[model samples]
Target: MSDATTSDPGTRARPVDVSERVALLDVLRGFALWGVFVSNSFAWFSGYVLLPRAQAQALSAPGLEAVVSGLYHFFVNQKFITLFSFLFGLGFSIQLARAEARKSSIVPLYSRRLGVLLAIGLVHLVAVWAGDILSTYAVLGFMLLLFRQRSDRTVLTWAGGLLVAVPLLAPFVQHYGPILLHGAQAAAQAAKASNEIDLRAKEQLLAGLSSDSFWTAQAANARFLTHMVPQSKRLLWMASILGRFLLGLLAGRYLLLQEVERRRSWHHRLLFWGLVLGVLGNGAGVVMQRLRLAGLVDPARDPWMLAMSAVMEVGFLGLAAAYVAAFALLFQRERWRRVMQVLAPVGRMALTNYLLQSVVSLCLYDGWGLGLIGKLPPSRCVALTLIIFALQVPFSHAWLSRFRFGPAEWLWRSLTYGRRQPMRLAPGDAPASMTG
Candidate 1:
C-alpha cells in the first residue's frame, strides 16, 4: 500500500506509476504538430506577411479569391497553433500525473527538459530562423510549472482572465501607446524589409549560386537579429502569446481531470458547437478583410478588428478541443486505433520532425538550395505539404520498426537520464496494447 497524502485528509494514498504514458495523446500531438506545417506552409514558402490577402489576390478572380479566403479563414492559422499549445498543456498534465503516482518531484525533471528545449530552440533560432516558437514555449512552460499543483478551477479562472484581458487591452496599447514606440517599430520593419529586398535583388542578379550567397544571407540575417527581433519580441508579448499559453495549460488540466472524451454525448455537443462558432467567427474576419480591401472600412486600425481576431482565436481553441474529443472517441475502433498507433512513433519524436521542418524549409527556400521562397502559390504549397506528410508517414513507421525510440527522442532521454538509453527494438520487445 502507498502512503501518499491526498488533498482530503481522510483519503488513502495510491501508488503512482511515473512511467505511465499515453500513446493516443502522443499520436494526436503528432497530428496537431503536423497540422502546423499544413497551415503555415503557404506563408513559409511564399514569405508573405498576410497569407489570406495573398491568397485572395493570387486566385483566378475575385469570386474565387473570396471562396479561397472563406475556406482558409474557417480552417487554418487560428486552429493549428491552438492545437499545439493545448497539446503542450496536455503533456504537462500527463507529466504531473505520472509524477504524482510515483511520489516523485516533477519540478526537477520537467525543468531539465525545458532547459534542454530552450537551448535547442536558441540554437535553432540563431542558426536557422528567428521565427522559432520552441524557445517561447520553453519560457512559458517554466511559468506554467508554478501552477502545477493548483486546483483546476483556480487555473481555469486565472487562465480565462488572462486570455480575455490580453486581447481586450491589445487594441488600447496599439492605439494609445507612445508615438515613439510606434515610430520605432515602423523604422525597424522598414530597415528589415530593405535588407531583405537587397538580398533578393542580389540573388536575382547573380548568374549562378555560389558560397557568397550563404555569406550574404547570414549577413542579412544578422541585421534582422540586431534590429528586428527585439521589437518583434515586444509586440509578441503585447499580443498575448503568454495568455494563449496559459489558456492551453488550463485546457490540458481540464482534459486530464475530467476525462473529457469519456463523456460521449457532451463531446459530440462540444464538437458541433466548435464547428458552428468557428465558421461564424472566421467568416466575420473574411468579410472584414474583404471590406477593408474594397476601401469600405479600415480594419487595420479598428478595435473591432482586434475583437474579430480574438473571436477567431477562440473559435480555433474550441475546434482543437473538439478534435481531441472526437479523436479520443473514435480511437476505440480497432482500425482507427491502429492508424493512430502508427502516428504515435512520430509524435514521440516530434523534436526531430520539428527540426526536420527547418532543414526542409531551408533547402526549399535558401539561395544555396532550391530557392523557391516567395514564388509558390497557395495551392502548390498545399500540394507540397501533402507530399511531405505522405513521405513522413512511412518514414516514421519504418524508423520505429527498427528502433525503440526516434533518434531525437533517444538522445533527449539519454540526456535526461544522464546515461545511455537503449535504442533498438529487441527481438522479444512488444508494442503496448491500446487503451483509452
Candidate 2:
C-alpha cells in the first residue's frame, strides 16, 4: 500500500481507504492492544484492584507469579497505554494533514468524529467497565484541536512541561491541598475518615461485582465511576495523557514514521537513549514498588515519595519510545517485518477488539457470567490474557477479510458521517488488503 495521503475536498470527509494507511502504525496499534489487554485483565478485570490490600497480596503465587508481577510492573503496566495515546495523537496529526492536503476545513468533520468517539466512550464506560480509557481519551482529544495551529516548537515545549510538571506537582498537591484548605489537624482527621469510607466503598463494590445479578454489578460499577474515583486525581492523570498526545502530534507533524528509513539514524539514537532511560526510570520504579511492598519505604513520605513520583511520571515514556524505535528499526527488515505484520489486522480493528476484550473478560470474571472474580492468580490471569488474545489474532484476520471495518469502527464512521458505511468489501477489494 502506498503511503500517499487521501484528499477529497470535493466530497465530505470520510474514513481513509485501506491502501492509504501506514502499515507500521496499524502494526504498532495491534501490538499495543495485546499489552493493554494483559494489563487490564491482570489488574482490573481480575478484581485484584478491589481486594483488600492484605488479601490481594495473599493471592499472589510465590514463585512464578512473583516474576510475572515484576515483569508486568517493569514492562507492561503503563507502557502500552502510553504507546496507545501516542498513536491517537499521531492519527490526529495525520488527519489534520489530510485536511490540509484536501484544502478543506477540519473542524466540522473532526469534531463530529470526536463527538462520536466520546459517545461510544461514555456508553462503554457506563455499561461495560469502569476501567475504560476511551471516555478520557475522547474528552482530552478535543484539546488537541487547540494545538493544531500551534508551532512545532510550541507543541513540543507544552508537551515537555506538562509531562514534567504533572508528576512533580501531583505529590505536592496531594500532600498539601487538604492542609491548605483546612487546618493540619482537620486534614489528618479528614484523611482518616476518607480512607475508611473508601475501604467501605470498595468492599461494597466487591460485593456488587461478585453478586449473580447483572444489575447489581452495573449499579456498583456506576457508583464507583461517579463517586469513588477522585476528580482531582483524574485531572492530574489527564495532564500526563495530554502530554503524551502532544509528543505524538509532534512526531506526526514531522511524518517521522512515514519516512522511517530517512530518519534511521534518529531512530537509532532514540532506541539507545530510550532504552537507557527506560531501564533507569522503570528499574527504579520496580525497586521503589518492592520497597513499599516490603514496608521499607512510604510513598506518602517526602524524598522517597518525590523520587517515586518522578519515576511514575516519566518512566513509561522512555520504554514506550524505545518500543516504537525498536519496532521501526525491525520493520525496516523483511524478515522481522513479516512476523510483526501479523499484528496489522488486529490493529486495524483495534476499537472492536479492545471493547471485545472488556466484554469477554467480564463474562469470564464478573458475577453475571462465570464469576471468576478475585479467583484467578496473577499467573493464571496472564495465561488467560494470552489465550484470549491468541483467539483474537485469527478472529481479526477472518473478520477483516470480508469487511471494510470492524463493527465498532463501522458504527463510529457511520454516525460521524450521518450515513451507514459500506461494511462488506467491494467486489474487487482484496480480502486482507486495507490500511488503518
Candidate 3:
C-alpha cells in the first residue's frame, strides 16, 4: 500500500496513525479481489453468458470442462468472496479499535463508512457492472453493529447458523414455496436466459464475418445490456454469494474480538483441516459431475448434487480462511512484506480499483468501447488481468503516498460527513478526529 505523506499545506505537520500492521490483511484482500477479477474477466471479455444451456455448454470442452468445474467447485463463488467478506469484518474491528483508542463513538463513524460504501456500490452497479457487492456489504454492516458488543461465542453461533441455514433453506423454499413467491420469477429468468443465449449466438455468428452489419450489432448490444441488468440484480439471491458474506462476517467478528491469527498452532491446525475438507468436498463435486455426465446420475432431479455443492462451498471457504490466517502468521518477512505492502495500497482503495476495473475492461472488451468481447481466450484474459493489476499497484501506491485516502475513499468520507475531507498527504498527516 501507499505510504502516508502529507501534501496539503494545511495538514502537512499533523500526525498520521494509519495502521501498518493491516498491510498483511490488505495483501490478502488484494489476492481475493484479483481472484474475483480473474473469474469476471472470463464473462467480461469472452461473451460467454453463464446461463442458458446452449452458450454455457458451447464453452465446455473435455479439458476445459474439468478445469471450469473444478474452479467453480473450489474457487469461483466460494473462496474469493469469503476472503473479501472476512476482510470486511476484520476492517470493522479495526475501525472500532481505532475509535476506542481515541475515545470516540463507533456507531456514527462506522455508519458513515458504510454509507460511503453503499454510495460507491450504487455507482458501480448502475453506471458500470451490476454485480456490485459494496452496497450489500454496507447494508449488512449496519445490521452487524447490533452484535458488536455481544460475546464472541454468541456472534459465532448466530453467524454459523445463518450461514448454514440460508443455503439449505433457500433451495427448498424456492422449490416448495408458493409459486407466487419465486416460481414465476424463476420461470421468467429461465426464459430470459434462453432468449439471451439465442440472441448472443446469432450476434457472434454474424459479427465473426463482417463489421458492416450495423443492425445485427445494434440488436446484439441491446440484448446484452438488457440481459445483464436483471442478471446482476438476481445475484443477491444466489446462495453461494450470501453464504460467503455471512461466513466473512463471522470471521470478522472473531478476528475483531479474538485475534485468531495471533495463534500459530491454531492457525496450522485450521490450515490442515481446511485442506482436508476442501479436498473431500471438491472431490465429491467432481465425482457427482462426472457421474451426471456419464448418465450414472441426474443432477437436475437429484438432491445429492445440491448437497455436494453445499459441502464444496463450505470446504472452499474454510480452506480460504485457513490460507489467509497462515499467510498472516508465516509471511511476515521483508521480501514478502514488501510485495504485500504494494498490494495493500490497491486493496485499501478497493472501491476505486474495482470501478477502475469496470472502466478499463469496458474499454477493452465492450462493443461501445474496444469491442474485444468474445475474442479473447482464458489465457489472454488472465494476462490482461495481470497487466491491469500491475499498473494499478504502482498507481495506488503513488496516490496514497501523497494523499490521506484514495480518491473514491476521500469522496465517500466527504459525502458521509457532509464536509470536505483533507485529501493530500505529507509527513505527519493526520485524519480528522471524529466519533465512530
- Per lDDT, the best of the predicted structures is 2
lDDT of every model, 2 decimals: 0.61, 0.85, 0.60
Q: Residues 1-436, candidate 2, lDDT per residue (tens digit)?
A: 0012367666657777787778899899999999999999989899888899888887784888788898998999989988999998998888888889889877788888788888888898889888888888888889999999999989999998788876887777777888899978887798788778878888888899999999999889888887645757677778888998999999998887989999999899989988888898889988887887789887445445764666665778889999999999999998998888889989889999999999999899989999999988899999999999999999999998999789998888888889998999998887553343
- With candidate 1 superimposed using the best TM-score fit, by how many Å does residue 54's alpha carbon deviate from the native? 8.0
Model 3 over residues 121-224: C-alpha lDDT tens digits? 87665555545667777777787677667776776666655556555565555444544666757855765676667567546533532244434444554444
lDDT of 1 by residue, 146-219 (tens): 88877768877776655565555665565445335668577457656765765554343232222237665545
Q: How many residue pairs clash in each candidate?
A: 2, 1, 14
- With a 3 Å backbone cut-off (N, CA, C), the pairs that clash in candidate 2 are 18-435
Q: How far off is model 1, as Cα RMSD?
A: 6.2
Look at candidate 1 and give me any clashing residue pairs.
16-101, 16-102
